[model samples]
Target: MYFERAHISDEELLSFYKQLLYPRMVEEKMLLLLRQGKVSKWFSGIGQEAIAVGATLALDKDEWILPLHRNLGVFTGRKMPLQQLFHQWQGSPLGFSKGRERSFHFGSRQHHICGMISHLGPQLSIADGISLAHKLRKENKVSLAFTGEGGTSEGEFHEALNVAAVWGLPVIFLIENNGYGLSTPVEEQYRCEQLVQRAAGYGMRGMRINGNNLLEVYHAVKEAKGHALNEQQPVLIEAMTFRMRGHEEASGTKYVPPALLEEWAKQDPIRHFEGFLQYLHLLDTEKISEIRNTLKYEIEKDINEALSATSPAVSIADELQDIYAPAPSAVPPPVTTPVAEKRFINAISEGLRQALERYPNLIFMGQDIAAYGGAFKITEGFSDTFGKERIRNTPLCESAIVGAGLGLSIMGYKSMVEMQFGDFVTCGFNQIVNNLAKIHYRWGQNADVVIRLPAGAGVGAGPFHSQSNEAWFTHVPGLKVVYPATPADAKGLLLAAFADPNPVLYFEHKALYRSISGPVPEEWYTIEIGKANIIQSGDDISIITYGSGVHWALEYAQQHPEQSSYILDLRTLQPLDYDAIRTAVAATGKVLILHEDTLTGGLGAEISAWIAEHCFTSLDAPVMRCAGLDTPVPFAAELEKNFLAKTRMHQCIQQLLSY
Candidate 1:
């Protein structure tokens, strides 16, 4: 009756049935492989097949979808090769992620599918970015992102929904409310009677439907897509379904009630749909048996091929090589045109202005960045010049904004996210480290995003606002960290950071923003990311530092003109200039490292260890470190002065010079 009301063609209904059954067959085969210890793990979508198949089928192939671990049907329905899928599950080198990731943890850009991370909620915001790209390009495409009932508890869920609604982006937020979230019941999950009701809070349309009913799911999703595309608004759909199996193959169903299982079994989506097909004369028992048999045979064939596929070889060199995309080799020669003295802040602003003018696909996202010109006025006139779409003013949701930046990068857009303060980056840390830093290494997906951190401790802003947190990202493998000491490097390195294909953390010391001034190039230019600049050359000791510490080293050298110290300003921290560091240490034979971050696990530690290991024979004395104390930045001026490395620079240099 529902099928008749929907007016779907009989052939199309049969095709849908086949699509729905394919995932079920594939899952059943995977379960067998799991029991036999062939496959490592499996997230069963056996009962919830209708929702994934129906919703995916309703969308255009070019429209992106971010699916969860259990949505195996989304992959099958999208026509991703079964052999490749099996290979992916089996950790084969020929798999989508090249065996770097397992299960549905990988995405295929060619298929318009962005896979979810272990943390379920961030993908929703990434979907917002993809939808934003579609809207910006005036394309009639909608992005659908999936989450479970329990995922709504995360702050990212609230932020993502609010952002989409505020922007009126064409996005379909699908929540597969399948009774439980890995053993926690819906009763424990939400206070609302239904998850769809939460959409009203975001000022978006909401819909609830029986997820088990294939026809109902297809019709509802198709209608939701229409509404999103026509109105350019986000729609939240809560598909009611039951997880017939445990969360995964290994996680048993003992926690689920037998009575509830028995009750839901009578409403099995596959059987219910098969009965409907029989009634309509579209399929019969014999036909169903034949289809199942044929599908089983094909699934077995694919599984066999996957089993025969070569496993990834254990090679550390190959893995290290694959971590980052090859750096661009065609860097334009640095301009030697007329120069003008400018403040560091103005230089950064100029570089951003030039980058925006050069790359149309480049966009900026952060709180108060548009009309209000951001927290520090770094983007004072950006919104007015570039327009609001490119220079977006985001909500106070760092996690979602970072994820959205990653999504934009996935869609060929470069994004710059400015954290109001360096300390606030903790809010978006997960997205930066787990999603953006890992995406390219996981799937060869470039995350060309730049996060600007206004860091350091000299203005007496206290613990929350002035801490230098660059070391946190510097430890991350896929991120490039750059800290400039002067106006010229600030402008030139920022341009270089934007030009790099990898994710970059550009640290701008708040203390030096307006205090420092130097001659910057009048024309567009770039300073190499991993190169160091020698401010003043000497022979007694090498004072190696970056950002605010560079200024401290210069001041110390100026005060003690007798101490011949090589003031080496390391602009880029991640891909450090080892050659320059060696040259400095070898020339002076005595070295001192300095930074604003805490000393124990700071960048100084890494640099000292490397120098001790590689340049020990060249050193006349031990490598010394002058860094901030291991405590929260103090509010008072005296305590703050003691907490900073500048207080100890005189003693540290005196000792190193005497040695």
Candidate 2:
């Protein structure tokens, strides 16, 4: 898996680079845009051109590549339309953001390559997940992920490497070590001798190559693809390159030493690679001249195309596109399928396994969800049975994982992408909020994606790992928030989410890993998404809940037989079955909403407002809600429970009954 440094003509290493410089030219113009007060901020992949151009040669156009903001050359070199990119830099209607996202944060799902995020380290994990889908589909395509040396400092980078390495996923983590993570020099960034060696920490092999050498970049990526596709393991290639200029076209060189720039300018990748090609007799002087002149023409053409590209067609409809999958067949069997018995995790696992079996397009992705069976072992034995292509373990980049899920879902794959810990979802908020949520609203529901978060606090998971931010998602109008309280609902709800046309955020409570077990059906079933599930019939009070709180409400109903109470599990937060809630509220006259998220904006408040608005006439007393106090989930077990929804759920139910 190692290749000695050799300069040869067997492979034209400069294939991607020959056309890459043109984009760098565009980068300069983009900087002009910043100066003109067009773009607010810009992150250019100016110096690290070889990796972007060369790596594209190792990947198939049908294969996916999720580049970070630093690697725009890959898209331009790969023949991504210049107008689209120009639309991006200019923040025009044609820009990938569609008026909502930041500049240069563009991705074209149609091209099979999604846009990139500015945050360090998320793209690595996102690429790992997409590779999982390609593997599951049994496609030879590998996902090519890009990042820079400074991104290595992020825990997501390590998390992604470790998970993809362990799962043997078909993903290539291309770490372009171009010397700095912003003003901080790499030496200040890390203590490692070579960044690639860090891969060993995750039990993976890595290598360093002269990043500026296009041939070296190509050779490294070729080997990486082999290890990735054939071995199903991840590979890290530290392309040791240098940036010749400031970070952005507008960035001042106050921190970047003039001597270093002079030294790097001498090693210009564009000139160096072209000269190397001629020295190797791969091209004559005439070809070199033609390439330079042609690249100049091309670069100018890209700029003109970008400038005159009709501003990407001003369309309000573009905003409604690529948000969620299509709605399930409204004619789904009206009667329920006979339910059988299974465990909670098994229900979710089996439902996904069965969904994969039933739907050829369904794919499962998350950290250690394949061979290792997920952190909770829900997907154990799944990869072996469905093969790594279907059940995939991704790199631990939450944002990238979510973004790549956005890409594949746009590719028409029903992707179930997860953030290992719900808390980690913070790593990918932009992807979730901007991309996933807006896809439907922007282009009339043009996306098909399912994002899963393992949420809530329990099991002594401390602060970094535990969170229930379902309330945050409830605010997103285009996304459907579904949190099941039972095994059967978990299976059924997932089935529905996969089938639903809009993006669905399925939040799985970590605390319920074992506490809230129920009989899941052996037969495949999908509970309706966006609809609440009522667990118990009551007359005195209505305990409405979802996820973990649903169980607590049911337990309360069982324990307090003295009060006949009804329970409605708002299985979904968005498109909340207000009709269902009103019906329940009208009958019960007293409502208690519960959840594990913080109280300030907990989903309960929304439900209460909706009920108070529509069913105010039916209320016997006042509607009340139970939720965790607004605070981080404390590590102390007793204190955490006191801060959790269990105590809150009981209190709310008690208050409702007393009312």
Candidate 3:
């Protein structure tokens, strides 16, 4: 037993002492490593240990903790192994991210702690999804998501709070009001006297307390947890505190006021708490000194072990590996029998319905997705069939929806997110690119969420409503980008995406939504993700394309029967079937790559480059590409028509044939 005062038992106070002391010792040890050039950067949470320790200790083991880089106390409080923690800091092979990420930027699935992205506020929305899943599962768990006071200024903060409150989820948003965001003081960051007051605007209970008071923070979180478990009400608690050190080792205290530092230093949380323990006759000078000495010795030993540990034996193979989750053992073969013909939109809806039917944990979320059937009616009747819980209508917050899907995915659910149009994916670009796309490689976690994008132009929807943004996601690693042209492929690919344990960006061309119909299996089926389809077989020329481009390529092939061109539809863009491409290019020496996106930096460029490098000698002529001009899709009908017309494709094909 370490100490006892008032209602606190000796055992509990002893645990608190260990939590407080461990982080301090670890921070000190890491600082030495930084000086020795062993570790790269350090975020010292010296003065703010009380908040992390108190609140994290209050959580049940099953409850989740989403912490930022500075919350070393939370990891210590959760009893994470000291050696693993040191390995993470030292960038050793045993680190949770296998040395791929910085210290404190990784999560442990075994510990129920999520690795954090550098962008902070996005995790708030993700926490909402996690707590929402817990609520849906009727679990007696509450998720605690932490961020600095400055992070509240991010738009995702408001979106997360609003969604949690609206859905009555069991999530606790803890803002460590640590006086400053780097060198900028809190006063200049926001107009509110207290950050907690903003919670009222989001329709959630809010509180403000001195973060240095360990007992105060603990009781507040306990009360919040009770409310969350019983009432399913989300709470936001702003713990006013300060960072004893600069943001990182590189940022010195030159930006901080000397007098202000002295003032905060006087009320140092650990020192003040120790004083309280001494006054209560719970801890004496001798015992306190012994505790600190023991923690320092243990942390030093762990640091030595970590330093001796070898770094990950990195090679090009290690860098290339683990981009996608391992493929499933058996992919169900294609259903040759056709139940009925369906439009591309209906095919997608049916595919979603089948997925939802198969996986009870699957959820469908988007703006107006429930009752209104989304902007395109793809999810029509979903709310009635699957109920409001499974088929959710989200706010016009694209980033939040995507972030929430990631959170839900972390909780082992298949979350399908829909962008009303692919053009709006820009709104959620940060979450998609920085957060969702990198989750797998960063922490060995599978983010099994599918983002449905209604992409491409033809129906005069202009630039914002009609654009092929597949190139944006295809260019990114750790993401599978699939663009299916036909209804059958749409249904099969969507199902396959749900089964595969990776983040999939499914681009459904809006032009083919209702205009095109094809044979689709009535029963559930899955098409392999990285396989290309030969829509037409010929020997003269090879046309490689996907999405709406497939239609143009097929039309061109059908028109020029004498030329005998083979049309290859790349179903999935990222894990492209290079074998099939090689086969086509070798068979038909002449090749033309087509796409609906702009010419420069399009997927066509990648295909052309690959053909040039690998199939260079096989080429009868120079590989060619015809795509939209390097300009925005015009709102004018004539301009748009000329921008993505078959005439351009015909001109390219004629030039290739002439060559």
On lDDT, the candidate that comes out on top is 1
Candidate 3 overall lDDT versus native: 0.87
The best-first sequence of candidates by lDDT reads: 1, 3, 2
Instruction: Write down the TM-score for model 1.
Output: 0.98
Question: TM-score for model 2?
Answer: 0.76
lDDT of 2 by residue, 1-659 (tens): 12233654345444544655666776777777678876677877676777787788667777777777767767775677766666666666666555556654556665666665566566566676577666656788788777788888877677677767766777777888777666789889999888888888877768888877766787788888887777777888788877665676566567878888788777777777666556657777787677778866776786676666564456555444344445765223235656566667777777777777887887777888888888788778878888876676666566656765765665567778877777887777876776677655443334567777888787788777887888887787678888887887888888888777567888877777677676666776667776776677877887787877777777776787888878888888876887888888987898877777788877778888888888889998888878887888889989888888787665666766676
- Writing each residue's lDDT as its tens digit, candidate 3 over 277-300 gives 777677899989899898888888
For all candidates, the clash counts are 0, 42, 0
Q: Candidate 1 clashing pairs? A: none
1 against 2, candidate with superior lDDT: 1
Candidate 3 residues lying further than 4 Å off, grouped into runs, are: 1-6, 333-338
Best model per TM-score:
1
TM-score of 3: 0.97
What stretches of model 1 exceed 4 Å from their correct place?
1-5, 330-336
**Residue-level error in angstroms, candidate 2, position 337:** 5.2
TM-score of each: 0.98, 0.76, 0.97
